[model samples]
Target chain A: MEHFIETIGRNMFAIFGVMALVGGLLMIASKSAIHSVLGFLFAMLNIAGCFLALEAEFLGVAQILVYAGGIVVLFLFVVMLVEVSKKKEGEVFQLQSRYAVAAVAVGAAMFLAVFRKAFFGVASPEALVLRPELAKGLDVAHQNAQAVSRGLFADYLLPFEILSVILLVALVGAVVLAKTERV
Target chain B: MVSLNAVLLISFLLFSIGIAGVLIRRNALIILMCVELMLNAANLNFIAFARHNGSVAGQAFALLVMGFAAAEVAVGLALVVALYRRRDTVQVDDINLLKG
Candidate 1:
């Protein structure tokens, strides 16, 4: 029974991972900007699936709320605002394709070779575990969101506060940049 | 539980796809989305590593990445729109004012 559950989980992870990659590909493959946004939306949703499968419950929900909902909708607004559909986009890919393809292909091959050895070797990476004595409260039984929130508001309070400031500056800058009239 | 190796593979592939998209695509918005894809891939790695290490720090960092990426997209799209307004082009090739 345990093995069956494990197999099912693995299969679901594969499904989510593969679908996410497909969506990412679709983002590049489609010429239409709106279509790319749609693909990105699909990718973000599947990535959220990947997050949930990994048991990062807080991240999974945040992924949906932030990436899938907020950022993607913002992309759609910009795509329409710019009126990409009004004009036919000639030459969807960059001019220097041959070099880019070669670079990406070589990089991908290197990565795969390294990952295969690292993952499948005698001492698997999964075996290396570090359950810190300090984080006793972060056990699996604890609710992930509560643990995460505690970590955020307690351990990472400074950075969390800074992130809010960054968000404020970014929003103001975006508005200033996009405004038609002089500031 | 999903295998750590499998999660790593997915993250790597997603990141590679994102790199390919950025290098291959000409549309500014598509490229921006690709950047987001790459960021998501990194988040996957952080979460998976967090799980493997039995800690929540990775999740916290992933949240930080999400927040930063959101801000990045807002600014990026704003720039895209601003460029569109100025020269009426979203293609990366056409907006080469810096080439001057």
Candidate 2:
């Protein structure tokens, strides 16, 4: 019964993972800008679910809070502010559809090459193995925001501080760029 | 348990889709969204590897990446808005004033 439940959980994770991928594709392939943004939201939510499946509960919640709550709203605001005229509505793609095909081919080739190397490069045909010690640690850290905060504050303190500065700079830059001067 | 390879494959596919979107899409906003998709794909890889290797560093880095992504979106959207104001359009092909 435990094994069955575990299998079910694993399958659910796979479904979420696939959903994330498909949502990304949808975002890219959609004709309307609003549709693309909606697709991005879907992708973001599913990615957060993926984080939860991996037992990174803090990251998952942060993804939801930061991405779904903050970023998506920001995107929607920008979309609403920017007027899409009738002329622009028809021009969904660029002039280089052929180039897009080439791009897709190149990307697919890269994925295949890397996938082949990662999976088949080693001579040993062993199944995926989880590190027991790390697994135990992660199991403890799972759904534990405190563990993530400890690591952020202790080990990655400098980066955390630097990120705050970056955010501030971005805020200032955005204001400067978007604000129109009234003459 | 789900295999790391499966997770990685999904990430790769998402990344490729983002690439395709970036290449094909003319709208700067959609392109920005595609870039976010790519970033999310990379983050998925980080979390997956962290889980497989049993380290918290990957998750930490992923968080940092998310922060950077948010900053990037802010600046990027601002630039887009400014461009639209100046050129009255957000199409990449239309913004060719810098093509000297």
Candidate 3:
């Protein structure tokens, strides 16, 4: 049973990886703003799945809540709220193939350089290693949630508090930017 | 061999393409999508490294990145809307309000 769970987890990680790639491509090729937003949402969802496979359930939930649920919806709302005329849609879809070729070239170079250090010995094994600590929390996923809370409050307390401050600033800035008049 | 590195490589490629598009394109929405793509790429890297290292920190960082990315998109879109209202357009070339 443990081995079975590991195999499922490994396979899920691969699936999430593929999904992320597909979502990225869709985001690039999407002509409409709505489509781009949807593509981004799909990509974020795949990343959340990756977080789950990495045994970071808290992060997965946060990804879903903040990204897929919050940001994409805001993007959709803004797209609808903005009024763009047909003539004003200039250069929105004009993608040059040369740039894409160059991007692919650069990506290939980076992949090749990192492939040796990262994936050479990976062997593509299907074996999953289930940590005993993770299984303790499986019965009730959110009952205690110690790893995340501990990390946030103790180890990462300073960064966490700083992030809250940044969030407040962002909220105020957003409101000011969106307001009709200068204040 | 379809290893974790392969997965990371693919994600990186997609992400770089997204970045290149954002840098080269003039469309604001597409640029925002590209930014999202870059964040996703980093997220993929975090997860891949987490799995390889057997640590949850990478995944936690990815989550944090996602939060910031979402907030960034919200602020970016709102700014875009405000820009549209002021200039009646969304082209990158036209945002020269303070070119003094």
Candidate 4:
């Protein structure tokens, strides 16, 4: 009975994981661009669920806000703003689809082989050695948001600030690129 | 508790699917979405590892990754818009300049 309960506990994350994969597949396989975006949205939400399952509460919320609220909206606006004439069904996908799928399969196999050889694989040790700065680790609070905030504000402040500048630059670059009239 | 292996497996599958999508799709926008799928897979790995290590750094890095993904999508979609303006098509195969 105890083992059964534990299995159920583990299955929750599995459900989210499966849904995420399905969503990603849907995003890729859809014919219409809007349909593809909708599929991507489904996948993003399920990924947030996966984050929450991993107990990364803050990260989960940020995923929804950034991807769902902001990124998807941007994609939708572009889909609407641009008057892209949908090509004929035969031309929707690139030529030689079967060959591309095969190549991707080979690529995925190589990817798996390389990563499995390098990283601490599934059978890795639980006690991973973190950086000395963050080795202090989460406190007794054990709060997901607290730990993440401490990491960002206390340890990663410089990168955090630099990221802001990057976002600003990207914002300016986007405006310049998408401007209607050229100077 | 989700095992580290399970999470890793999920991330791997998601990433493979993303790669296939990118190669198979001709729409620039959908290809961009496939790229987002790949990024999410990487982020999933980060959070899973963070949880496994009982540290906050993985989550922290995931947050940073999210920011980068946002900035990336902004620039990429802008490029898509620019492409549309010049040639009026979002199909990648049609985005060639060697034609007469």
- Candidate 2 residues lying further than 4 Å off, grouped into runs, are A1-7, A84-86, A95-100, A113-143
Indicate the residue-level lDDT of B100 in model 2: 93
TM-score of each candidate? 0.90, 0.86, 0.78, 0.85
Better of 1 and 4 by TM-score: 1
Q: What DockQ does candidate 1 score?
A: 0.62
- Residue pairs with colliding backbones in model 4 are none
lDDT of 3 by residue, A37-132 (tens): 787788879878866765567667777888777877787777776644435455655456677767677767876777766673544332222246
DockQ of every model listed? 0.62, 0.57, 0.46, 0.58
Candidate 3 error regions (>4 Å): A1-10, A83-90, A93-104, A116-120, A123-144, B1-3, B96-100
Please name the candidate that would achieve the greatest DockQ relative to the true structure.
Answer: 1
lDDT of 3 at A162: 67
- lDDT tens string, model 1, A112-165? 898878783231234112235434655544477867777677678898999999
Clashes of each: 0, 0, 0, 0
- A1-183 in candidate 2: lDDT tens per residue? 999997778587688988887788788778777888888999999989988888788899999999999999998888777855536556676646787687679778887888877772322222223345433445354345655666566678899899999999999999999999773
The residue-level lDDT of candidate 1 at B1 comes to: 66
DockQ-based ranking, best first? 1, 4, 2, 3
lDDT of 2 by residue, B34-73 (tens): 8998999999999887777766678888999999999999
Error of 3 at B56 (Å): 4.0
